[model samples]
Target chain A: MENNRGNKYSIRQRILSSKLTFTILSIIMGLLVGAIVLLIAGFNPVQAYRIMIDGVFSRTKYISYAIIYATPLIITGLSVTFAFRTGLFNIGAEGQYIIGALVATLIGYFLELPLVIHVIVVFLFAAIAAGLWGGIAGFLKAKFGVHEVIATIMLNWIALYLNNYLVMRPFLRRPESESSYDILDSASITILEKWKYSETGREWLSAHPYIKDFLSAPANLGFIIAILLAILVWYILNRTTLGYELRAVGFNKDAAEYGGIKVEKSIITSMMIAGALAGSAGALQVMGVTKNVIMLPVMEGYGFDGIAVALIGGTTAIGNIFSGLLFGALQYGGPKIQPPLGAPSEVVDIMIGTIVLFIAIPKLFKIIMNARKRGEKNAK
Target chain B: MLNDIGFIIGTSLMYAAPLLFTALGGVISENSGVVNIGLEGMMTIGAFIGAAVGYYVGNPWIAFIAAGLAGGIFALLHAIASVTFHADQVVSGIAINFLGPGVALFISRLLFNGSTMTKSLSFSAKMPRPLNGLFRSNSFSDIIFNQYATVYLAFILVFVMWYTLYKTKLGLRIRAVGEHPASADTLGVSVTKIRYFGVILSGILAGFGGAAMSIAVVSNFRPTLISGQGFIALAAVIFGKWKPQGAMWACLLFGAAQGLTVYLGGAGVINISSQLLAMLPYVLTLVVLVGFVGKSVAPAASGEAYEKGE
Candidate 1:
């Protein structure tokens, strides 16, 4: 009996110290907090959650929408994770994203090229534009010792207003519309879009309604590209010499400098790569989803949401994919609760906020574990 | 021309008040070794609560105080996570940002019958202008002096903050704690207590900043109303090199830029796009940071979690 109790305590100790256990505990705590808030607001928490889950999973169409939502989030999360690994915070991802979309939209609308080549051209230009946009902050930090947070924050506002200005220009704006003109057919990345909507294809798909329903949404190559990029990012971080230098700089700039790593070069390179990743996300979003840049009165928050995704994912590439999907599902399905349970959709935000808050305090888990150990000792 | 200059000064002061309050908060918290980047979030909650209370209670003073209390409550959460639990200050601050708007919108929807915005307050319910009738309408003095009471309070607070931070024994202790908490701890000062006081006080001032916006500048609470103002204030804190008086000047410069944008766009004095005009302040901030202020160092112990007896 003594041996068994000792084994149980050790197991509990190991579980409490593990990262995965911490994440799970944070999530559960978030949900519990959400439920308490719901109860106070006079809503049934269980019913609200049920509605949310059903909304996301009840139909193939809804699942596609969730994946669609997750695509940009996953890519941007990877962007943030990459910067974080290099000891930099790329808060300028939003600006880079805007620049990417702006460049892609301009190229897609103006250029006349063949199918694959046009898409490649658009993406390349977009990446370059956004890479430069992000590189500006990196350059400022490396050269002048200005903090990246302030630089990036300032850059974000510039990008926002610049996007609006460009979109409102006579050449860019669609006739009688608030948004820019849509991309050419060759620039689109929607999966089998032509065939999916053609008369004969629709007739054939009628027999397979599930596939048809899934494609009915703007299901595109973005998610697949995002997954592939995640794998690529993971490989780069784990397997490459460049990744080594960047991680070294991240760990300790002084140590890395002593070890002959050019810290300034690493900072700039890391930011550029991170920017390209975020830029690609914006390009893909334009090619596959919106197809044009629309003027925004406020930020769309894709980049801000990326920060949450990166933090929740433990800053791992693989971890980001799962967290991105979770966030996507919550965001996509949050409104379902509003329609039926009469609970505000903002409850999802509260839940995510609470999760992040809990995750910020890993010491809380340690305190809990210590208390448990003391309680067991007392009982003996 | 005189009226235009008066309008410019008046508008600049109006815009500067909110940033001044929040930047002062940032100055205090950071001076005490706690980096309160969550000032934006605190301001957001304060804005919502201020507007909601002003509309419902029909008293601007009560609404302003309520807003500060709401901000203080959120700041306490930040203090707990970053101080007591030894969490990363930046991460905790980010969480506060998320929680602030989340709670604000949730409660707003609940209270306002599913609307995300609080009802607009009446002019009588809005912040009072103590100097309104002291000068003729549209005169230079009227434009410069006849402002909301919050504006006056914000300026006075700056002086008070500067005096407290520089002249008092408590101020010396707070500065010592920020510069080197270990040394201060050795000297018998309580690092934790000072940090808690700094963080919570910062939150209260940030709350007042939010109320300044909601009750004095704007009359209603909406999602976008307080957007980016907190961040701009943050930049002011950095621009001012973490000094209260310095931050005040930085905020005034940014505010003047804003005033210029509004004036140029509304008056059509320049044919530039409004979007382009709106970008001026942000661009100017970057230029000034790069060209004039090459390096602005933070407090020595800022953002570091202190372990007692370590």
Candidate 2:
């Protein structure tokens, strides 16, 4: 069924094939696997899929909320993808996320500035803080020759405890409250009551009444920024010289070095950008959703999740968007799976783990390729 | 202050115990060329199985053996995946990490009700009050000396492992295989067999380490409690330069850092936020790892899977 004769292709198409096919396949594969998982759990796969679809596309509010949920994942996923593209594994996204949020939280709490400036300051400071946090691993890797994987994992612990310490110390939250001081209305993304309801369908089942009152992905305008950033990332990767050098380094360090690329510099820069992306995610989450940085009990574990996102996305920019959305859906749908079947929230995590396992098993793809080759030969 | 110093050292020593076992586990596996990233999970599993067996069988010794056996079995899975099937060592290690927690969570859930957390034993699972009225008039001796049996075992394991690795023939082959499997293969050593033994030994050590946490330190099993100690074990593995004695010191030092965090958190000794103090051990790993990256060479082929035919 393959057309060998129509082999002529432009340079753009080759790049597109490497990026697009994987993105499409990952999205489709994640969904299909997710569906199978749901089916095995005794839920109708179709119904579960419909619930997720309805959750996202069923209303304007849902879509906004879905976009909101996707905000940090998109940002964090991009952060991860950026590093992967540069051949660095920044598994400390969680740490960077926390440090970013902590910076923003500290800023948002003390500052009484006007809304726009307040949000901008919070996000910027957070990004800088997180970038520096990630830069440590990069710095260590470059200077000391330590593996980023080991160092970043260590960093995750430091972040977890560091955030916990913040929650307990100077930022010691009130006894009844487990969070930081709430930000002023300027920093918060309170959904406008006017836009709360579904514009298309005002009916009871058509719109969720709780959608207006509930928490969001990244509450504020950060989701919009994250989406716009993805487009920019696409441009950078496909249209910039820096992107080419970074990618060449990622594809083969020896070859890239031979090709006159400063591989080490590229790695450090990539890690900084990756950290910045994750930090932005933290900023968005703190400003948009939480309004202030509320120290949670544990590090959000999003960075660890981001690894899976980057991997399944083939570590590409645009591909990360779809794969991230897929991951986001699984994460969002995870809570929905509870209560009915009495499964723990960790079941979703277990499934995510399994999906990572399935993905890592490259033999499945090898077998598929072999079968296709055999078919082609038999046809000949 | 003397009591505090004594307390800190004592708790640090106590914390060092599990970490020592874990690092030894790291040493065992890495010495054979497999990096056991699942040590934390393996430890968790060990804790559960140890607790369950110890609790039911009424014999803590049985718990230790059962835990080691269970850990050996888990190692077998890694052995097959990495050695025979030729999976990426990191990938397989990660898979075991994922699988261990899930299986533990699932099986724990099946056995317990009302909470996802495993129920605490009727008594401390493996911890026994030391001194046994040897100094009924002395609170100091009881408080300082009394701790779990596992804690003592972990310390003993440090020397045991060092002796086992450096002063033994089997350890030589294990080290040789880990360093250069191809060269070792030509020397007529069963490269695969040694690697399998190395990884399995690691699982057992890690399993015992996990048991220590559940039994000696926490006295219970819970999600997120191990809190990346597996990596700490890894750091100890590196910080010790992959040597048992050095790793034990690192583990004790890191463990003390942990004990200090808790002590200071409890006493408010440092104005440093408890969260910041909590970050100490992990942050310190970086500080430690950076202290000697190139100087401390790993087993030459630590993360690389050894393929026989290749």
Candidate 3:
């Protein structure tokens, strides 16, 4: 028996074995596939990609726009990542998100308080509502052995319809508009908006003579909050006892149960936490971006897209922030690509799908490595 | 009242047909020990292909086959990822779901000149109802008998799947492999092959379900056409307790819920908005899933990768 412990491998060898190698390779392959699709569709791939990149970073304001789009995505990524680590496939994040948004919109309109307290109240109620929404599925899984995937999906539809109903009612409804009425000024959170110094939109530009270049992008307090939450989630998962127990239950429920960990309780808690993160995402979206509710033809696919973000990030806390940003850039740039390139913006969707497909098959790297080893053995 | 009930039953059967095909596919795949959440993706693909083909060829039957074949091809990707690469089934399924809509939408833009929808086919091109002439005078008979051909076919597939699963040799092998792969392998069954068959069949069924939506029900392909029907079908599989006949009953019940919503809302019998009414089926699915209707057990190795000589 040869002991391989403490054996130093070359940097190249280590890099080849590292999990990030596969992720990077998958990303490259995904981009290449997307480029190929673009080329096939009669567009110059280089030009299209260049345009996308340039558009996402075109101005000081554009960068903020990207971050604004990223806010919900990062939160949703954390939501999905947390559930994944806890061994639950929470396909119901979409439902949780909408419920959170609904609660936030309701509270934002009804609650009359100072700005900070109102925002806090809206978020708190949103999280509680969405947490309970997600908890129902968890409870079902724990008690009745119901599959969470099925339960969550069903809940998503229910949430969508419920939101539609809520948005149409008198209290929330805006006269002569499909969307709900705007939240009170106290409930809104906008950093750049305040900097612009106008009562509304670009009006502040004239009043704030020195702020001509002030980038009044949709970027707001939500993006900052999302980034902080990601770091906090990483710390909790890596350092906390609750996370350790949750991970143990995720790894093997029977074994964890046998080890005296309350597996069922962990499941409920993990789902609730995941739900809270997603709920906050929706709440933030309403408070930071829309400030009002609109009737949606479909549940915004943010929750489903969160799955891609979590998967591409390898389900790490820090990785989620980067991946969320990457996706946000793509989304911000997507509309720009179509007008100039004749490419459907949906190509981004295809690229994301292909990337996830490649990542899902990590054994592909193993097979390649084994083949190379076999070749070396033959040469020897 | 009787006419309204007939309308509800008719709509319910139409709605249930798609769920039936998808749920049967789910049962077949899960029975063979592969969990497929990609049914939604597969159905999306099938619906798009079915609609595009039907629009071009003007033949509903040809469109249906093309859809099923397209579905089978897509499912093969899942098989390669989950079976050959030993990836997580859920991950592979999710990837497929993503790909399905992306690919469909991309191709639609290419073929249909940037529209997210396919060219609509004439109502005459839809699946024929053979009993329409005979049942012209009777609402009950018309509703039950004079429906899309796929509606009849879906009910028929329930018996077909039930017999195949419980009575056929292939079904036994699939069940054995799904339940205890190592033991099945010892008995000389190729677990991989059986699982592949099961997943592929699921794709085909789900694909046909997609075709049922576009060709029989809607007659056009929209990105939102498949929506969450695939997930509802999944719930049907669980509610039915992984049994084909049980799945049919569950699908019908869910479909009936959808149909009732339509009837009540359309007839102004219910003062609630249609959006709120739409919540009935999904809420029912949640309630049914939560309530212990019976002992619903999934196949033992449904989501695990089987490794030889592990």
Candidate 4:
């Protein structure tokens, strides 16, 4: 029998076909599995989901609040997507977000300028700082072929320290509070319309008829940036030469090289873009949600959640938005799930993790079996 | 001032000691072909179970042994899933890491009257003063000799790992399996068994590392208290270039960096933002990674499971 070694269908088609199928299947699979777990735990699986939906979208107000909640995640999700498209797993989004937030927050607090320039410079400063942070990892990988996973993870720890420093050191509160100085009001991204907050925020809770008092969320403008960036990222990834090179490299390095793409430059650029998105997300959170840049427990785990979002979305920015919305909803309404058996918000995390675990299986097993079969053939 | 240098080395070793043990374990596991990303989880479980057993049993030595066994079982889960079932190592490892604290916290709440942390049980596990006295002067002896026994074990493990990796046939098979497990299977090496051993060995060391934390360093276990130390050990492994001795040095450097962070941070000596100063070691780890970027290559099949045939 002839060996089909390496002559399998091209990655391009497999991606177009299999990835879509895998993604849909995984989502369904995750939901089903989670329902089963819920059922076994003696909870009404269907009701739990209803409550979940209710938590995120029982009213127009709720949905608005959910989007506000999803803003930073969408930003970070786009960040991860940008790098994934280029075959670089920029796991350091958390770090970049921290650095970006700290840098921009310092500018927000210390420097006085015209509101427009102040906002523009702060945002740009954040994006640039995060880009440089991620670029360092990219630079190392490009120059030395370091595994980006290891590099990015380490960077995350560094970010934790740097962020901690900003809150405690330069940006430390006048009274040593675990916060920075409130950004100048001119630079602060305030809610322009108080009525919208009444409609979409915790203020609306007073009007909630049944159990409304229990639900309150900070409805902010970061969600707008999240959605806009998601759309923008979709365009960049699907309709650009840069995106072509990136996907090409991710598909097959040798083939991408053959196609005349500069693999190294693409990786570095992709990482930079990933960092920028995360940084922007960080900046927006300070600008939109909180008036001041508080210490990390603010951005906590959102960056990591971006990985799950990208995976759940199968790495497409559009798909990420849907998944991001779904994730945002889960997070938004999670703590509100009524208990006897509501399970902590971690249940959603476990569910998300289980889905990714399922997806990682086929890829891992295929390579193992292929090598074994080759070994068996060689032995014979 | 001169004694401060010895004191720093002594203290750094004490701090790096746990990392060295864990990094050594990582070398064996990765070299033998299991990714063992669950080191963090394994270490945590070790800390939890060992501390629990120690608190209940009132014997620190038993806790030490129990920690190794506990660490091994957690790792065995990783081995069964990834080594036998051919699951993704990273994902599986993450599962274990997440499961570690979650399950431990759940049990701790139920058993310990809802106080998540075990009661304090501080007792020095340092080596005898006599051992250090013979090698160095009285001052050095007091610094090094009075350290935990784990320090000696870590030092011994480094040399032993080098010997096993180079001199022993089992080590050779382990290395071969990691690089090309399929070939090893053809030669009747039982890639699964080798991988299992590799992972379990990592667990044992990691467990001991955890035991070091509980018995020697903190002498108490808090929920999530290890706080990413296993990852630091992982970084140490990369810095050490996947070799036991190199990893030990890496651990020492990281430990010293951290020690200085604490020492200076405590004294308020470094006027930099305590936050920035605190972040220095983590940032240093990132810088160290750049040096490791291209220099270190993992075993070819480190994270890949071995299947018999299509």
Best by TM-score: 1
How much does candidate 3 score in TM-score?
Answer: 0.95
Query: How far does residue A323 in candidate 2 sit from its true spot (Å)?
Result: 2.9
Candidate 1 lDDT over A1-380, as tens digits, reads: 78877674567667779887888798898899999999999999999988989999999999999999999899889999999999998877888888889899999999999999999999999988888888988998898877888888888889999999999999999878779999999999998889988999999999999999899989999999899989998988889999999999999999999999999999998888888888888999999999999998888888878888888888899988999998999899988898777689988888998998998999999899889889999999
Which candidate, 1 or 4, has the higher DockQ? 1
Supply the TM-score for candidate 2.
0.84
Tens-digit per-residue lDDT, A1-380, candidate 3:
13445557756777887778888888898889889988888888899899888988866666778888888999999999999998998988898999999899889998799979999999999999999888888888888788888788888988988888888888778977789988877888766556465567467566654344335665579988898889888987889999999989889999999999998898999889889889999999999899887888876888998988899899988888988998999888876888876689888878887888888888988899889989999999
Query: Which candidate wins on DockQ?
Result: 1
Instruction: Give the CA lDDT, 0 to 100, for residue B87 in model 1.
Output: 91
lDDT of 2 by residue, B1-310 (tens): 6667667766777787777787899899998888777686677677777666666665667777777777777777777777765666655665566556665665565556524466665564456656556754435555556667777788778888888888998878989988999999999999888988888888998878877776667656777666567777877887788888888888887888878876886788777666666666676677777777366488998878776678
Candidate 4's docking class is acceptable
TM-score of each model, paired residue for residue: 0.97, 0.84, 0.95, 0.81
Error of 1 at B227 (Å): 1.7
Off by over 4 Å in 4: A1-69, A112-121, A170-172, A189-216, A295-299, A322-353, A363-380, B113-116, B122-140, B269-296, B307-310
Ranking by TM-score: 1, 3, 2, 4
Q: Residue A211's C-alpha lDDT in candidate 4?
A: 32
User: Rank order by lDDT, top first?
Assistant: 1, 3, 4, 2
lDDT (tens digit, per residue) of candidate 3 on B1-310: 7777788999999989999999999999999999998898999999999999998888899999999998898899999989889988888888888888888898998899889999999776677776778876766768766888899899999999999999999989999988999999999999999999999999999999999999998889998899888878888897888889989988998788778777876788867788876887777766766676555588899989999998
Instruction: Supply the TM-score for candidate 1.
Output: 0.97
Best candidate according to lDDT: 1
Candidate 2: where are CA atoms >4 Å away?
A1-3, A6-70, A112-117, A169-176, A189-220, A234-238, A251-259, A364-380, B52-58, B65-77, B129-144, B268-276, B279-285, B308-310
Ranking by DockQ: 1, 3, 2, 4
Error of 4 at A380 (Å): 35
